[model samples]
Target: MKEEKKPYFPMFVDLSEKNVVVVGAGTIAKRRIRSLIEFTNHLSVIAPEVNNELLELETAGKIEIRRKNYDREDLYDADLVIAATNDHQLNNDIYSFCKCMGILVNVCSDKNKCDFYFPGLARHENVVVGVTASGSDHKKARAVVEKIRTIL
Candidate 1:
């Protein structure tokens, strides 16, 4: 007999004051950084180079930007890590390191390597509806989110 897989649902996580690290400063990394800012003030971005948006945020002191390549030491003291680099191998390595450190990690390139999956969401007042396909289909999740958007 096959064991049943548990279903995971969207949760309202409190990230205020939590230390979150984003590994990259490209377009994808920038997007994740933007979302994280809404949740936590203690956020850091690590990258050899940063785009204009990240530079602006760094200059404003909204986030601490480490203008350097990813280092194992960078993972220290981080509650959450986001692997948003375009290099798939680097992203995988970051995920593996986070796993060993028992830190929660999200890999933008592949969902299978991620410890947590972020879904497309729709918000209404305090209510938030998140849609995910459990790594099977992002398009389907997007479609569900669109439907939810129409309803809410």
Candidate 2:
């Protein structure tokens, strides 16, 4: 017998005043952070080093960057968080802590540990479309998003 997994509900949240914290500013983190900054002003990224785009956003005062290794205390005030570190154990730790704190968290590498999945977004003048494959097929999801982007 096969038990069906529950699907994630898609919802648009208001992050304008929410404190969103991202641990690790590598490729995955950078991608998600860029999207998040579009919806929220209270965005923070914690990592030992970040890429040029992230640095530019910080310089523009659009986001706050903590250029240091991630610490548990860094998430103490987070309303939502994204664990995008290269270290699996660290991502797990962040997931566990967010679970305990009742904070929403997305674990980039491990879908099972994620409280929410970051969808592929396609936005136009005033319309936005979010696409996901329930963590089963990222390429397909991105392709669908691209199609939607062109349509929009």
Candidate 3:
């Protein structure tokens, strides 16, 4: 018999003033970074190849960019960590480190490796909603968010 995965708990966190570390500068990391910057000022990106947009954010003091490979020391001060790098092994290493340290982390590559799943978020002024399909179906989750957005 196969066991089913537990569903993600829906909760709103106050990252408004927390130190959030993003461990990549690729497309997925870029997406998360864009959304997180709207909420936090202490968003740090550690990547070897950060794109122009992230550099611009660093220039404007919205985020701090460290252009290099991720060191485990980065997690020491992070309130929340997003591991969106292309390396699966690195993401797993981060997940394990966060688990031991009791830090919240989201691994973009694998659902089983994630301590938290990033939901499709829709914000209308003060009203914000997040939709997730338990990581089974991302398209459905996105569609649901879009539908909710249309109605709200």
Candidate 4:
């Protein structure tokens, strides 16, 4: 039997001026939002209820917040979308919607639904190392990250 290898494409993206949208305002959503802020200055968060952390970010003028549930129109102006809602169906919906629009999306509920997986990342100064097992074994990925951490 012929073995097939999955394609891996790596690219560096400059999110400095991109318009990124995050759906949901829970803890997971907050984490995703915070990470995005590190790379981009333009961030839009959509959720009916905002958590204290996100509210704080809004108060600091770190990101734009929309107090409303997600709608298809929300993805129109987004350069990237992060579906971090606790509702799995909603996340799936957002993922599908992004696909139809040819937009890059990350679904927190399922890695398979995401166009790109968020790997375990270690940062020191300006150096960042990301580790991933392509969703096959996250534990192994974490182990790899630990090894990388020791070297960095």
| After superposition, candidate 1 runs with Cα above 4 Å error | 1-7, 124-126, 147-152
The alpha-carbon lDDT assigned to residue 103 of candidate 1 equals 95
lDDT, model 4, position 60 = 91
Tens-place lDDT per residue, model 4, 1-152, is 99886845555688889889999888788878877777888899999989788889889988999999899998898989999998999998999889989999999888778788677877777787777776678899899889888888
CA displacement after TM-score superposition, residue 14 of candidate 4 (Å) = 1.0
lDDT of each: 0.86, 0.91, 0.90, 0.86
lDDT: the better of candidates 2 and 4 = 2
> For residues 26-121, what per-residue lDDT tens digits would candidate 1 score against the true structure?
877887887678678889999988888888998888899998999989998999999999888999889989999999999988867877877787
What TM-score do all the candidates reach, one by one? 0.82, 0.92, 0.90, 0.85
Could you tell me how far off, in angstroms, the CA of residue 71 lies in candidate 3 after the best superposition? 0.9
Best by lDDT: 2
Candidate 3 residues lying further than 4 Å off, grouped into runs, are 1-6
lDDT of 3 at 61: 92
lDDT of 2 by residue, 24-50 (tens): 988888889889988998999999888
Candidate 2 — number of clashing residue pairs?
0
Clashes of each: 0, 0, 0, 0
lDDT tens readout by residue for model 3, 58-138: 999999998899999988999999999999999999999999999999999876677677789888887989899987889
lDDT of 1 at 131: 82
Best by TM-score: 2
